[model samples]
Target: MKKSMLAIGAISILFFSFIATQPKIYAQAGGSSVPFLLISPDARMSGMGETGTAIADDINAIYWNPAGLGFLDYFPKQNPFDENEELRPFRQVALSYSPWLPQFNADLFYSYGTIGQYFDYLQGTVAFNFIFMNLGEFNRTSANGDPMGKFISNEFALGLSYGTIIAPDLSIGAQLRYIQSNLTPTVAGQQDAGNGNSVSFDLGLLWKPQNLPYITDRLSAGFNLKNIGPKITYIRESDPLPTTLNLGLAFNIVKDEYNDLKVAGNFSKLLVKRDSLGSDPLPKSLVTGWDNPGADWSFGLEYWYDQVFALRAGYFTEPSTIGGRQYWNFGAGVKYSIFHVDFSFINTVEANHPLANTMRFSMLIDWR
Candidate 1:
C-alpha cells in the first residue's frame, strides 16, 4: 500500500509538473509533426520506429490492449488468504503475487500512462489512461536570437472503455476520452493565449477464431478508431486533433506452449489533411498542413523464441515531395519471470540528415 501510494504520488507530481511548465502557443506557427506517446516499452524494441500493435500481458497491457486483462490466468493455485495477496513487486501490480478474482479483478498501471484498471466477464474492461509529453525548453524569438523567455506545450487525457465477447471468437471495445491542451498564453500576444482543450474517443475490435486453416491456433485481427476528438482552435482558429484509423493482422507460424513466431501488418490513415496536394487557405498558408497526409503508413514483423527473446524491424514514410521521407526502425527485447524489458532504435534510411542516427530508449516491468 505504501509503494502504491508512492507510485501514485509520483505520477501525480509528474502529471501536474508537465502541465505547469507548458508554454504559450504561437499563432499561425507550425513546425515538425506532433510527437506521439510510445505506450509499449516492450514493443518499442521491435523497430516499428513508431506506435504499433503490441502483445500484452504486463501492466502496460492497459495501454496496448485492455482486452488482454481477460486472458490472464493468474492466481490459479494460491491460498485463500496470503500476505502479498494485494501486493506485487513490480512498479505496478505484481501479477505473480496478485490474486485472480473469482469474478473480477482490478489494478492500477502506469508506464507512459497513469491508469486505474478493472476487468470482468460481463464488462470487458474499465480503464483510465493519462499521457504527458515535455517538448523540452525553447526560447521564442524573431529571426534574430533575442530573449523571448521560454515556452512549452503539454496535454492530459481521461479515458473510459468497455469491451465484451460479441462473437464466440470475437471481442470489441470502445473508449471515450476528454483531452486538455495548454500550448502557452503569451505566445499569442493579446489574443486569448490559445489554451485549447477537446474530447475524443477510440473504438477497437479483436478476433481470434476457435479454429482455422494451415495455422491451427495462431491468428488475430484488430482495429482502432483513434483520436476522434472535437475540432478545437487556439483562438477560434481551429485545428482538428490528428484523428486516425488503424487496422492490423497477426499470424503465428508455430504456436506452442514454449515458443512462437508472429508477423503483423498495420495500415493507418491520418484524418486531417489539405487535399492531395499540400495547399491550403490563408491562415493555413503560414505553414504547410500540420500533416500533409500522404503516406503516414507503417508495417512491422516480430519473431519470438520461448517467450523469452524477441527480434523486430519495420519502416514508416510520408511522401518524398512533402517533407523528405520518414525513418526506419530496428528493435529487440527479453522477458523473464513476471518482468518484461525492451528497447528500440530509429534511424533515417534516407540519404544524409543530421538527426538521422537519433535513438529512443524505453523499458517495462510487469511485477504483479
Candidate 2:
C-alpha cells in the first residue's frame, strides 16, 4: 500500500509538471479563475474562521499546512499502552462534503478527501488529497440571445504532500497539485473554451516549541506559501494563479488533562500583482505585492472537554477593497474511539451575501 501510494504521488507530480508548461491566461481584479481553491474545505478549519495554517495537526493538514502532519503521534517501537504491541505507525483518513453558497444555489457544492500515514523507515509523513467543486448547471446562450445546450461548470485538484520534522521544534512540508477547471464548451467566437489545466505547489513551515522558560508549552507558529505556479489560459486572456501567503499563531489559553481552551489568529495576503500595474519579474512581483491593499485576517477560539467533544467560534474579516468578506463562524465536533464527526456554519454580516448561512460537514477515521 505504501509503495502504491508513493508511486501514485510521483506520477501525479510528473504529469502536472508537464501540463503546467502549456500556454496560460491572466486576469484583472476579482478576475482570477478557479477561485474555488481558496474556499475552506475542512469543517474543523471552517469552524475556526478558516485559520488552519497553525492549528492543523490531522489529516486535514494536507490542505492547510502539510508541515503539521509531521506531528502525528505514530505508534513508536515500544508502545506505552501495550508493550507487546507491534511496532507499526498509525494511519488517518478524512472525508468532507460542503454545500457551498446554499443561500444562492443549493446544487453547488464542494467535496474533499485525504489519507495520511507515517513511515518510520522514512522518518516522515505523507498524504494524498483530492478536491472537487461543482458549480451547478447553467443554460447556455449565444451572444445573439439564441438558445443553446446546457452546460455544467466544475473544477478538481489532485495532490500529494510530504512532511518531516527537521528539528526538535520545527517541521517543514511541500505539496504538488494538478488542477483542472472546465467552464464551458463552445463560446460564440472564443476558441479553447474546453478545459484548463495547471499545476501549483504549496510550502509550509511549523514551529512548535515545548516547555518554554516562562511561557506555555502549547504555543506554536506557522507560515505557508500556497498556489505558486505559472499562469493559466482559458482562451485569450492569461492570469496568474491565486498565490497567497499566510502567517498564523496558535496557543492554548487553558490546558489540563480533562479540559483545554485554544485560540488562533491568521493573516493572509495575495501575492499576485494587479493587471493595471506594470509587470515585474516573478521574484520582484512577489515582494512588491506584499504592499497590496488586499489582505485578510481571522481569529478563532476552541474548547475541548475530555478530548471527546469540542465547541468552536471564529471571525474573519477582509478589507472592503479586497472583497469585504466579513463573517462569523460556529462549529462543533465529537469523537468516539477512532471515529470523529465535525460540522461548521458560516454567517455573513453583509446582507444578500452569497456565503450567508453556509455550512459544511466532515468525518474522520484514525487507526493506531
Candidate 3:
C-alpha cells in the first residue's frame, strides 16, 4: 500500500494548518514535525494570543508553564458568597475544545484535558494532561486508482508534570510527554501505513518577587523550553520536533477588592534548523536556528471583575519568513462557585484566512 506517502502528505497538511498557520508549506518554524504540540490548548490562553508563559495560573499550567503550579493556593479558602462556609478549590481540572480550521469545514477538531493536585509532602503540584486531534477521514485509493475504502487519521499525546518551589519567589517545573500519530490504518494484505511514536520533555522557571520595590510585587517573569527530544519518524524519513523557547512578562496595572487588570507580553522562537541537505541534530539546531529569523511576539490584556467574570483581548504577529500570521483574539470568561467557562474567537487580518473564524471553548472544575 502506498498509504505511507499519502498519509505522510496529510500529516504535513495538518501540522501546517494547526501550528504554523500556513496551508501549503512546512517551511515555517524550520519545518517542524508534530507541530500540534505548539498549539495553545486552553481558551483563556488562546484568547490571550497564546501568551500564557507568565500567567500560567490554572490547571492549564501543565501546558503553559508547569512552574506556575508551585504557587497554587494550597490552603482551602472560604467562599464568601456561600453562607455554608464551603471551601474554595485547591485542585483543578480543565477541558478545552476547538473546531480546527473551521474555514475548511473538514470535520477536524482538537481537544485537551488536564488535572492537577497538590501534595503537601512533596511541596509541589503534580499534573497530567491528554491531547487529541482528529485529522478527519481520508479516502483510500489503490495503485490503479481503484477505491480502497477510507481511513480516519488522528494524533494524541499524554503528559505528566511536576512543579515545586525551589526558592523564595522562584519555582521550577518539568514535563514529560509521550506522542503518537496514527496517520493511516494497516491494510489486511499489505504493510502498515504511516505511524510514529516519540517522547519529549519541557522545562520551565517562574520568578515573581514580593518586594521588588518597583512594581509592588506585581511584575512576573517566566520562561519555558519545550519539546526537547529526538526526531520522530514515520518510516524512513525523520523530522525534528518543534522545539521552542518562550519568554514572557506580566504585570498587574490595577488590583483591588472589586477590580483587577493585567497585561502580558510574550516572545517565542523556534529552535529547529534545517537546510537542503537535512535537519541538524538537537543541541546544535537549538543554536543555529536562531540565525534564521526574529521571534514571534504578542501582547494581551485581561480584566477581571469581582473575581467572577473576565474580559480579554490580544494581538499576535510574526515575521514573514516565519509563517507571517497576524490576528486578534477576544474572549470572555465566567466563574461560578467551583465551575468556570471561557470562550474565545479569532479574527484574522487577512480576508478569507483559514483561521479567520476559529473559536475555542474551555471548562474548568476546581475543588478542594
Best by TM-score: 3
| Runs of candidate 3 exceeding 4 Å displacement | 1-11, 14-18, 21-29, 73-76, 79-89, 188-192
Q: Where does candidate 1 stray beyond 4 Å?
A: 1-51, 54-111, 114-118, 139-151, 187-191, 273-294, 321-324, 352-355
Candidate 3 C-alpha lDDT tens digits along 122-199: 888999999998887777877777877878788899999999999999989999999998877787686655788899
TM-score, model 1 to reference: 0.67
TM-scores for every candidate against the unseen true structure? 0.67, 0.87, 0.93
Q: Rate the local accuracy (lDDT) of all candidates.
A: 0.48, 0.77, 0.84
If the candidates were sorted by their TM-score against the true structure, best first, what order would they fall in? 3, 2, 1
lDDT of 2 by residue, 1-368 (tens): 11222232242232222112101112222234466778788888889998889977898988888898888747455446886777667589999998866764437688999998998887888999999987566666655756576766678999999898999989999999999987666666666775688899999999999878777478999999988887667676566677878999999998998999999999988776656553433555578666566678999998899989999999998765655668899999999988889999988898876677888999999866
- Where does candidate 3 clash, by residue pair? none
What digit string (tens of lDDT, one per residue) describes model 1 on residues 119-190? 443445454555544323334554365555555445456666555566777666666767666555454336
Clashes of 3: 0
